[model samples]
Target: MMKYHPLPAFLSACAVSACLFGGHAQAASWKAFSAEGGQAPAPLVLPDLAGRDVDLSAFKGEVVLVNFWATWCEPCREEMPSLQRLQQKLGGRGLRVLAVNVGEGVPRIKQFLERTPVSLTMLRDADSDVMKAWRVRMLPASFLVDRHGMLRYQIVGEADYDDPAQQAPVLELLK
Candidate 1:
């Protein structure tokens, strides 16, 4: 005879809830990389949808937002348009947003974009290698890099980039 353990079931439910709602539960704000004792970001060189290799180091003199997302992530899908708006609002002022799709083929990404339609630079991480290197545990992870190529802040989950408060960090970095 086996005793039913409520604790295990409770924990499992909690984990699922966290995955589904954690991003929204978290305050939508940038966390300072230095304050968290995070190391400089790893070298990032990935292929764009056009098969052109895009390197993070090439944008050293500009504020870069590297966003990790996937087609299946609801929060990621919800937040992408806002990211596009952010780019259009700030691109001329030296802000570049790289939307990296993790573990998805270009065709699927293209199909998603066909429906969602964002003009932000799209990059592919077909094997999720970059996601692992960046220690991303959730969808919609965003990193803000300063003009000097140093990582300044990070957002662990979905954020409305169109919001003034969210835009403030990118604006500050541009200066």
Candidate 2:
């Protein structure tokens, strides 16, 4: 039988509860930065939970939010619900959230999803190559890509993505 790691699971559940129940201080607001003079990132090619290859280039002409995360990260788990809300709010306007899970198997991700459901697109980067290519050193790094496929903004940490202020830049990119 597989041993259950109760500590990590309990801690992650606590983190999510804190965020849901008045833990605003733990969540950081995203800072908008200019991507001028920087080359557009190479295409993000990774497998979905179904093992189908998903390419970021395929999302050209749409505003895409690429988020690098892992099931082990508490903050990442906390911010997931808000990302789902953001996707629901702007999906009709061509906004897509691609959540890239770093260095984890489908079974682990499946277990995490069972505990915390998110409707956004989920991709797996089991080797973490995509995370390295995007220079994501943190657990919940996020980037906004314009309709033209250019990198426009980035959030280095977790944020309340459903908040209007945090959604401003993404909405603007859609225009």
Whose lDDT is greatest here?
1
- The superposed Cα distance between candidate 2 and the true structure at residue 145, in angstroms, equals 0.3
lDDT of 1 at 5: 27
Candidate 1 residue spans exceeding 4 A from truth: 1-18, 35-39
For every candidate in turn, the CA RMSD to the true structure comes to 7.5, 5.1
Error of 2 at 2 (Å): 7.1
lDDT, candidate 2, at 4: 61
Error of 2 at 9 (Å): 21
List TM-scores for all candidates, in order: 0.85, 0.83
Determine the backbone clash count of candidate 2. 0
Residue pairs in collision within model 1:
none
Deviation from native of the Cα of residue 83 in model 2, angstroms = 0.3
Candidate 2 local lDDT, 1-175, one digit each (tens):
3346443443354345544542345555565555472249766999999999999999989999998887767678888999999999999999999999887789998888988988788999877778778876566778988898888888766788878888998989888
The Cα error of candidate 1 at residue 54, in Å, is 0.5
